[model samples]
Target chain A: MELLLFNIFNGFIIGIFYALMALGLSMILGLNGIINFSHGGFLALGAYMAYSLAPAIGFWGALIVSPFLAGFVGLIVERVLIRPLYGRDPLFSLLLTFGLAMIMQDLIRTFWGATGLPFEVPNALTHPLSQVYFFITGYRVFLVALALLATASLFALLKFTRVGIRIRAGNADLEMVSALGINIYRLRAVNFSLGIFMAGLAGVLAAGRLGLTPTMGASLIMPSFVAIIVGGVGSLVGSLLGGIIIGVAAGITTTYYPAASDVVIYLIMAVVLIVRPRGLMGQEGLLE
Target chain B: MKSAASRHVDAAKPADAMSSQKSTRRRVAASALVWALLLTAPYWLPLTGGYTDLGSRVLVFSLAALGLNLLLGFTGGLSFGHAAYFGLGAYGTGLMLKFVTHSTPLALLAGVALGGLGATLFGPVTVRRRGIYFAMITIAIGQMFYFVAVRWNSLTGGEDGLTGFERTNIHFGHAILNLHNSTIFYYFTLFFFAIGCAVVWSVLRSPLGHTFVAIRENQKRLRFLGVSVGFYLWIAFAISGFIAALAGALYALLNNFTSPEDLNWVLSGDFVIICVLGGMRTFWGPLVGSVIYVVVQDYLSSITVNWMSFIGAIFVLAVLFFPWGLLGFFQRRIQK
Candidate 1:
């Protein structure tokens, strides 16, 4: 029973991480119509930035600041590198982002060293919350709470804010939005930054749990893609649900058959593709 | 280089009978020149600081990229999981040589069948999606194979990769074709490359190829005309898989080993980039792209450890500035 509970809790937490990453990737895909392969790089950058800043700004401060730095870099990249191919084939953007991913990974390795580094958390958050369920540390609880808060606020922002409404509207019909005289170029820049900010946040949280490595983002990114696919592209809530479900599935499988865990997520994706091609919450004809 | 110059002339010249005749003559001459260069590469490559092995590598990449372009450029199907088929071919050949049979012909046949059959099975499930979705699903599916290769340690050799595979010499009656010679192997690889090119060329000139191109131009129009677009796309996908597998099989023979990296999404990206970097629309684009990419990579990796970043930079620059590629750029110039 303890093992099951432990695995479930672990899976839930892993799911949240996948959801966080998928949400950012989904946003970029939604607004830009470009699969931002470099989103993984941004995630790593945020984590690495936090690692570097933790000494100077402290852990809490670095966690707060690193995402913003990542967002700023994302904005520059969108403007200078990504903006040109906005009207052309999405293939160009995919290739560009892929290249960016390679460069980002290599640069991170160059700066932070190739080996994994330990990300120190506050001592207060290190202790086990309960004797029976020692797997639930204070840090784990804190991480989950922060993720939930971030997710709730993001939903709220998309629902209520003026920029959020415009983003949603633009996603529905870019031509119609442009017909209304909205500056889509600026909107895309803001939207890209917003997506990158989420990725950066995920990075910081992920680093706290998984440690920091140059290729850490690459390993996690594919699962997030699976999360997005299962959640249904263009549906944020679906992305969340998809992430958690796959995480839990993977977590449970690790108990009995560890070799099959990775393959299980892909199996789920294949089944989902066969059963619900548009995903759980995907809109028909959005990407077709 | 000769082909590029003559293509320029072909574009510049009028479409009159006299000019058309000149264009045909120029094309035949260019093709002859290319064959001559390939035939003598072993002798001359050493002078240019290259070897027969490097030449074979370029041809292998060219074959892979050419196969990808059949779906990507000709048929308007953007598949990013071709590495699955390529890797299947590699592993099939390696396994055959390792445990099944020592006969090279039988091994190549098995490799091609393994990869081709895999594609045939997966192609139907994917044909429904278009554009980026298609690319995404293909990638996800490809990774499934990759995971299997990694986890199935006994059969696949796991992370260390499958070794103990070598190409065997062929015997026809009393004559022996010893592939131990690097030059002989280069010619051996070239023989397959020629067959692949001939297949692609013939397909492009056929009615089915026209239908594929029509789908690329506008699928809705073809659908209205009562064409089963999905079926045709599946055919193109399968054919490309066969060609890609053929290339992978040759690659395995060249290295005497196969690994999971051959099936990874990164290699799929490399194939796609090769297509775009040469000229996706042009028949000879893969050759041009493969030559430049392989030679540059050879030189770069020799000099610096930061070659990956440099290659990445090239991708960014290629997308931004040279989107039309070398041949496409020249064609555009001539037209203008």
Candidate 2:
């Protein structure tokens, strides 16, 4: 019973991280048809930034600053690389993004060697939380709480705010929104940057939980993709649900029948594709 | 009546000229060049020292890229998980040699069969979707295979991979073709490569190939024309898988070992790069792309460990500047 509880706890903890990662990718895909393969690279950058800066500026400061730095880089990429390929063939965008992904990965490898870097969890969140039924790590619980809070705030802003309305409108029909005197190009850039920022933030959180590594991005990329696919593409709620499902499934697989853990997520994706081609929460014709 | 007949003749001229003049001769010459190179490479390449190995590697990758071109270029399907077929081929051959007799023919047959079966099963699910969804599904399946290959240690030898496999003797009825000699192995690979290229050429010239092109141009219109789009796509996927497996078997024979790296997504991406860089529309585009990719990768990797970054930069430039690929670029210049 205790073991199951611990697994569930660990699952939710990791699921929140997955949700954070998938949210960014979902936004990018929703706004632009391009699957930004370099989102993982941004996540890696955020993780590395936190790793390097945490020593000097402290962990809290690094967490606050890393995402913006990553976002700034994302802004440059959008303007210089991605903007030109907007109306072109989709394959070109895929190829360009893949190239960018490779570059980011190589750059990280060059700066930080192939080995994993250690990241100490902040002391304030590391305390143990003992309850009547179970005991949980404070840091992990804090991570889940923080993620939920952030997601709620973002959801509220998107649901209520004017800028959020514009972003949603831009996603639905770019030409129509632009015709209404909105700068859709600027909107896309902002949305892309914000997505990157979220990815960067997730990276920092992940580094605290999983440690930082150059090749870590590669592992994250596929799972996040699986999450997005299973959850439904371009839906925030779908991403949240899909992320949790994959995370929990992966966590469970890791505990029992460990050999199948790596593949379990992909197996889930394949099953999902076979059963629900549009994904669990994805709308029809979205992929089209 | 005379004017209309003359108009008809005039209309047929460009189509005839386009097909008969450039495509036919160019294709023949390219095949002949490939054959000549394959025949003479073992002898001629040794003069440069270590060029034989490089030549063989180029041939292997080119053959694999050719398979990819059939699906990506001709069929207009972006398969992000082709490495699954490639790895299936490699592992199939490797496992066969490990347990059964190290007979090249048997191993090749087994690899091709396994690869075909895997593709037949997985293709339906993936081919149901179009564009990015198809690509994503393929990627998911490919990653699944990779994970299985890594975790299933008892069967695949885990992370270290299924190594220690010896080169097999190629059996032809009563006679055995010895692959212990590098020159002999090159000839064997050359034979298969020629056969593979011929098969691809035949397929491309078939009615199915035209249908594939039509489907790529506009699937909805084709569907309206009473064509089963899904069936054609499934066939393309299966054939491509078969060819990739054939390439994998050949690759296993060339290297005498197999590893998880054979099925990596990066390798699949490499094939995509080869197809696009070579000129997807052209028959010999994948061949040219594979040669250039192998040469650049080999040359650059020897010079610096940061070759990936350089390759990345090259990809960016290629996608931006040479959108039609090198062959298209050359064709444009010639046209001018």
Candidate 3:
């Protein structure tokens, strides 16, 4: 029972991570019109940046600041490398970002070395809160709370803020938004960085749990794609739901059958696709 | 390149016979030159610090990219998960040879069947979506196979990869075709490559191929015309998957080894880049792409540990400046 509970909690946390990733990826796909293969790269950048900064500024500060720095890098990258491909075939962006992902991974490996780096958390958050549920470490609880806070803040911003409203408007109809004299390019750039910021945040959080490796982001990114897919493309809440659902499903499977855990996520996707082709919340023909 | 006969038929278009004749003559000449170079690869490769096996590897990639282009370049479906089928073919062949038979033909058949069957099964599910959605699902599906191969350690040899399989000589009663000879294997690979080219060429020129193109051009319009766009996409997906599998089988025969990397999404990306970088629209794009990509990779990996950076840079540059691809750019110039 403890093992099952432990696995379920672990899976739930992993699901939140997936939700973070899928939400960011879906944002870029919706507004920027590319799959952003380098989203994982940005994620790694965030984690690595946080790793380097933690010693100097302490863990909490690094956690708060690393995602913003990664977002800064994303802003420049979007302006220089990605801007040219706008109004062009999405294929070019796909190939371009795919290349960018490789470059980012290689660069990360070059700088950090290929070996895994451990991320330190606050000492206060290291101890388990309850002896009965030994797995509920303060760090895990903090992670869950922080993620919830970030997600809630994001939702609030999107609902209340003017820039957030414009981002949403642009996602719906870029031409209409542009006609309204809203600088769509700036809006897109902002949206891209916002998405990358979330990726960066996810990266830092993931680093704490999984440790930092060049391939960590790459491996996690695929499951995010799966999460978005199972949740439904063009649906944010769907991506979030899909992530939690798959993570929990995977968690449960590891209790009984371990080898089949990864494959089971995909199997669920196959079942979802068969039963609900538009996904849980995706509208028909949005992409077509 | 596409079969010479089809190119001839294409050149005979009524709009402008004179330019078409010129284009046809130039293309045929190019085809002849390419074939000649391929035929003499064994003789000249050693002089150029190359080998027959490298040439065979190029053909393997070309075949896979060519197969993928049937859906991506021609049919408008950007499938990023094709390596799943390719690796499946490789695993199937390797497994068959290791566990079942010394019969080379049987192994090859088993590989193609295994890989092709995967695409056939999954093609419909993907066909329901288009563009990046299709690409994402394909990637996820491909990863499923990758994970399975990794987790099924006892059967797949785990992360160390499957080995102990060897390609045997073909028996023609009195005369034995020794595939043990790298040169003979090259010819054997070329024979299959030629068949692949012919299949793609004929398909592209056929009514079915035309319908596939029509769907790519305008899915909604075709739907309005009462054509079953989804079914056609599935067909394209299946055929391309089979082609990629054939290439995978050849790849296994070339190395006598197979691993989960064969089915990786990274390799799938490489195949797609090969298609786009070589000119997705051109029949010979895959060939040209494989040549540049394989050769550059072969050279770079030997020299620098950061060869991935170089390859990534190449992809960026190609997308930015050479979007039309080398062949497509030249053809555009010729048309101008």
Give me the candidate number with maximum lDDT.
3
Q: What tens-digit string does per-residue lDDT give for candidate 1 at B1-336?
A: 112222323232456788678767866886788788888989999999998999999999999999989998788788988999999999999999999999998999999999999999899878977877888888888888888899889999987899988999999999999988899999999999999999998998899988887777778878899999999999999999999999999999999999999999888888888998998877778888999989998999999978889889988999999976777787666545
Ranking by lDDT: 3, 1, 2
Candidate 2 per-residue lDDT over residues B220-274, each given as its tens digit: 8889999999999999898888888888888887888888888888888888888
Write one digit per residue (lDDT tens) for candidate 3, span A203-266: 9999998899998889889889989999998889899899999998999889999999889999
List TM-score per model, in order.
0.96, 0.94, 0.97
The all-Cα superposition gives candidate 3 an RMSD in Å to the true structure of: 3.2
Q: Which scores greater on lDDT, model 1 or model 2? A: 1
lDDT of every predicted structure (CA atoms): 0.88, 0.81, 0.90
TM-score of model 2 vs. true structure: 0.94
Task: TM-score winner between 1 and 3, please give it.
Answer: 3
> What is every candidate's alpha-carbon RMSD to the true fold?
3.5, 4.6, 3.2
- Give residue B67's error in model 2 in angstroms: 1.1
Judging by DockQ, tell me the better candidate of 1 and 3: 3
What ranking of all candidate models by DockQ puts the best one first? 3, 1, 2
